[model samples]
Target: MNQESRRALIRKLVASRGECSVEQLAVELGVSGMTVRRDLQALCEDGRLIRTHGGATLGERATFEFAFLDRVNKNQEAKTAIARAAVRLASDARSVMLDGSTTTLAVARQLRGRSGLTVITTSLPAAAQLQHEPGIDVLLPGGYIRSASPDLTGSLAETNLELLRAEIAFLGADAVDDRGNVFTNPPDNSAVLLKMAASAQRVYVVADHTKLGKPALRRFGQLTQWAGLITDEACDPDFVDQLQQLGIGVIVAPFE
Candidate 1:
């Protein structure tokens, strides 16, 4: 395809998917990486999308929705398993923070009946799930709700999270590398996750196996920031080994 057609295709993908890699685009277009990179460069130069190290994603003005409804049907089984494994990491949950993600919503749902636990989350669905749980006190750090996910962020929400120190923070990510870099799709979103983690004593990340090998545009924290990672068998062995080497525990869910 010519430059204009290729660039248009890339724009459509970024608009619909929120993020896309040069590798994915190259494979789909049946073109060389250089060609794809050139197309991306033109788009990036036009300010239509923002380019990362290996990929380009939607820019700030792009109407992207990071909603669970959009992502729910993708990896149901893996998300459930990851969430189950994540819950195991919290031994004593006096206070907790569940950063936004479909998997963390599963964990919040499971915590419904548990007592004396004060649950905090930026995920709107998660807060709603824990609302009626008799023994659980749910707090939604109110701020501007970004509906692509109905998440609370901005300086106000960040301040609220920073005020309370929790026993554990169950975080989620767009990607995690063998080198311990935790990536997020958007820079601002990552900033919130990092802030939430800092308010906790133990940071445990809950990610499905598919999230292991990819790279997102913005990075949230390093692997050393987390005490453990909860994922399933789909995770890369090399990445898991690296985490283990760094004193980061890896808990894989039981295959059912």
Candidate 2:
């Protein structure tokens, strides 16, 4: 496997197992111990792993961030397509709200080049991604960082979201059911997302085809509540039709 893919697998293994020896990883991955050590060193430098004497453990911040990155790398092409389409919808928006999802992080990456835009986000990674852009103003609400994810949560964050207004909000869901319901995986951030949706004049749920018909932990909102849904073209057409039958607008982002 390629270096990136190998490293991703190593991360997943370590995250799940809590720790792994270089010898164990090499045996499991069918690679040399030297190679596993090298990979582990790289992961340590990236703050995703902490190297032990002959093994590695997940870093303090790696639990959520590693999982987040893993999700971001999955179905990346679809997420990129969705981000392109989602950006077009924000062409006239001066202020935007972005939720702390990997898909929405893709949208933030697309917005990096744009200037004179105010971005309010609950995502630490999203804010970090755009913070270096001279043209975009990134704002993060005050809340305790989630232990399981790299985002803000709590009543403080929800109250802060209520005080702000945005022209448009782009959110990501863990699942989008057949009945036009949107769901989040862990349910901790549902209230924060609901507040974001409420504070925006328009909201769009950006997801990929894999999320269609999937079941998640909690229902955040209905597809009808958002202005529309932006998803990759690989989504089933019949499902799209079903959603449209319910008066939900779905935008299929074609692959570039």
Candidate 3:
């Protein structure tokens, strides 16, 4: 398996088992002890695990991170479908911006094989997903790391993003109302997302069916401000019609 997939498996194993020896991971993954040790060290640095004498255990931060991982897996089918459609929208862009949402992380997974692309993201998980891709150059803007999720936020990150530009940006929303207003959970994320949208030539909000016709704590921007909204087939047709009536471009992703 690739490093990303292997490390993800290691995290799941360590979380499930509470702890795992280097030898055990090596055997489980069919890799060398050295490889397992390297993976463990990386996980420790990421605050996902605590290294012991011969094994590793879940760290204090693991609970929150694992919860976020669970969120990522919640709408697997719809997120995957949305990601595939978003990828097609980004096919011609050489430089792309991605937000820290799990849906955008799905887009990052779909972009791993593309060559000569520059990916600017505030999501640590998305950067890690594409870090080993020789064809893609991943850039993370410097800022305060969020405790709620593996993302960078605050003024520094916004300033850094302002200095960069991308051909297209794929952002995720916590909720999107029928009026085509996009919302985010934390109010602070709205500013950073605005900067991301301003830095890109075109921006597309990628959300699943569950997020439609809902409003979150903070309103970021209207869908009219973006290039379009990409959602899954499960989205409500009436809601789609309402958005279309508002002159919003909506792309419904077909499940394969």
**Local accuracy by lDDT, each model:** 0.80, 0.92, 0.93
State the lDDT of candidate 1 residue by residue for 145-241, as single tens digits.
8746667888888888888778988888788888778887863487778788899988888888989967888877886767778888777788888
Model number with the top lDDT: 3
Itemize residue pairs with steric clashes in candidate 2.
none
- Supply the global lDDT for candidate 3: 0.93
Clashes of each: 1, 0, 0
Q: What is the alpha-carbon lDDT of model 1 when measured against the actual structure?
A: 0.80
Writing each residue's lDDT as its tens digit, candidate 2 over 1-256 gives 9899999999989999999999999999999999999999998998888999999998887786767678889999999999999989999889999998999999999998998999999999899999999989999988989877788999999999999999999999999999999999884689999999999999999989999987788998999877989999999999999999999999999999
TM-score of each: 0.71, 0.82, 0.80
Worst 10 residues of 3 by lDDT: 183-192
Residue 173 miss distance in model 1 (angstroms)? 0.4
Clashing pairs in 1: 180-223
lDDT of 3 by residue, 1-256 (tens): 9999999999899898898999999999999999998998998998889999898999879878788889899899899999999989889889999999999999999998999999999999999999999999999988999988999999999999999999999999999999999998874488899999999999999999999998999998999978989999999999999999989999999997
